[model samples]
Target: MSGDNPVDRPNGDDDNERPEQSKGGDENNPFAAMFGGASTEQFAQMLQGFAQAMSSPSSGPVNWDLAKQTARQTVSAAGDSSVLDRDKRELADAIRLADHWLDDVSSLPAGCSKVEAWSKAEWVEATLPTWSRLCDPVVARMAEGMAAAIPEEMRQSAGPLLGMVRQMGGVMFGSQVGQAVGGLAGEVLGASDIGLPLASPGTAALLPANVRAFGGGLGLSEDDVRLYLALREAAHQRLFVHAPWLPARLLGAVEEYAKGIDVDTSRLESLVGQLDLTNPEALQNALSEGLFDGDEIANTPAQQAALRRLETLLALVEGWVDTVVTAATDGRMPSALSLAEAVRRRRATGGPAERTLATLVGLELRPRRMREAADLWKRLTDARGVEGRDALWAHPDLLPDADDLENPEPFITGASELAEFSDLSQLGWDTSDPPVEGTPDDNAPEANGPDSPGNDDAGPADGESPDGPDGPDGGEPGTDRP
Candidate 1:
């Protein structure tokens, strides 16, 4: 019985007992521990956990489920209140009146098909899809850059652990987006507050809670503040609808800029060093607090060029909105000037949420030269009337560039010539060769409103760069990433 007892083995240990003990101890090796124990069931569970973490509500560059969850939690923490019935009625009435007033100042027709009053939480939910579209490419590129920054030997040695690094990056990005967006919900007065069409087309949405909070400091009546903001929203919708290409133009510019993002390898290397392979929860918590952020972006030439185009377009859009909104509210609203000045100041300094988003995404939607752009638009309206001023949207060729914003006189002086050229191009006639001085061709298609020219090789404007908006090798303005 004593010989049969494995525990009784002395200095002359049996080979069978020694091998059994060695095999059992192997289960706790570092490699096996990294895979969540040596048992096949344990390894399977670890993979299942990773899969669930990644493929929850949606899967791609970001963990959208985690993002939405975090955003709602943030909003709730900040005391979000649901939109009341009274709030909806007031916002709807204000928007309708705003549209009616805009009919006089704006050349485009009323574009508010629906007016919605949203709570801060609702705002987060409503804008999530647009946020996903704008942010995915940047985050994906960033993750790839982060992985590449790791030494090839380290990556190969890390092996299956690389998947955890990618998953960690997604979680970090998702948390960042959630916090920024949640903060933005409190700051934005309406869907287009930042001068982007964040909501559905023709859907003018206002957060009454935010509107009241904004007006509290202005000493203006809530009605006055609400109506003024409504005018701005209505004007934005009209411009977006009138120039169907504007939304794509603005969004595409952002995506193009994102393509040039260069991640900071040193910063990524530091992050990699801090990663606790055995303690994923600890690593995630540390990273989610912002070890990876836009501060790590290296400004490449392509990004700078793309930034210029984006700035010019954003300035033009906001300026047009400001000009038309001011015109609409000049005489009617007693606080129009005060309200407008308040808005300008807000944009100039940027709100807390705007700053957060800029830090997170490395992009600022606020136009730096919006005041100058506004002056140019006002000059165009004065020199060419509202119809002629707005006709610039007929084609991209006629729109003002950054230089035009600096010196409005040249653009205003040559406005007629530019208009003629744009009109000619719209007819598919070669602008280089002037048409015969004769009666109009009745069979030719009528010059429609702001529809893009069908011809691909339309000639460039005089003094305009032959390389197009950015540079010679630069892709088309607003070209999507291949």
Candidate 2:
């Protein structure tokens, strides 16, 4: 027998036997040349590696660790510079003083228990958990749509392969989230730059590097820019802390919107079938262009309402912060007005990262009526003091509705009147009752006619003295009345 024969080979070596040599035309076979004529063992190893990757524990809708790692890598690759110690100290001092200044302007007390300066990477790490909360609902919906895209019969036949598909979906969603967050990290100036409480409670963080970049071309002092940004951040922290229900309310709107997400199964199925797993860039492009494109999904009426609510709430928060920060920095920073206008313009015209986030979540963070909302807040402050203005946050019902933004006069007037009424009630006044009809009006002519009680001069005209002893000084008699 030949040495290569199965009879002479080892027990396990039989499965590894090579095919008979091909003719000269084999050299011209492109497929063989491309893979270097991969042997059966090599292909098996590749499949094994894939299987191992697929078998990773399916956490939730996203592989969070992978997402974090990818975000850090992305930030690193984007050249996120470290914050110098001096800059860090300056940031801390600025934030602290900003909080102090805010205390004078806003009723909400200082909320930041700790302040720190961060690099872009640190920002990603600190804010990732909040992003997860914000993103989970949408990502879960996408994962469900992906799984449901397959027919029941096909899914049953897929067996273990179905798990692999789910794992792949997690990876894909995680990658997209990482990309969005990394892009945002490079642009955000602080934890609350996006008008959401992205950082942990009692902690205020600033990105010195990003702050420096933002102030570079404005011809403004770096200190003024940092201080202005710090005031905004500090104001956000105060509002979020004082209004305990706000965070949940904002997040609930996002989730409510997410609940209405319905993916087009046909398009998703087609995309999945055509996805090129070997090329990550191709997969990302396909996802963005095909699966997540406008044509692939549509929001329901409820989702639209939820989005409106979210937008209004965001606008209110940002507007209040803007008003409060402006007040706090009014005289202290000479460049405050210019900085405020710059910030407004920046927010009104969002950057690429914000747009990308909107595309991904189907919810725009940019408050369309931010200016109007800010005006409303300022009107409220002018009509009602800071206490009355901040009291609106005491209850959701007290906050201004979308209609209130169109003409804030009614809302401001009503709020001020209500506050005044509340004060009267607290002082034991019966505001419900009508005023005494004959009560002397302070601005009316003096009551000098005969009908008045003080018309004693006419009544006693015939008397020797108009003022009798008892009438003038309440003496018992005219004798010794002094």
| Top of the candidates by TM-score | 1
Q: Which one is best on lDDT? A: 1
| Candidate 2 least-lDDT 10 residues | 1-10
lDDT score for candidate 1 against the true structure: 0.63
lDDT of candidates 1 onward, in order: 0.63, 0.62
- Model 1 — which ten-residue stretch has the worst lDDT? 1-10
lDDT of 1 by residue, 84-126 (tens): 9999999889998998898798666776666889999998887
TM-score of model 2 vs. true structure = 0.73
State how far residue 176 of model 1 sits from its true place (Å).
2.4
Q: Which stretches of candidate 1 lie over 4 Å from their true place?
A: 1-58, 279-298, 352-357, 360-368, 418-482
TM-score for all predictions? 0.74, 0.73
Query: Cα deviation of 224 in candidate 1 (Å)?
Result: 0.5
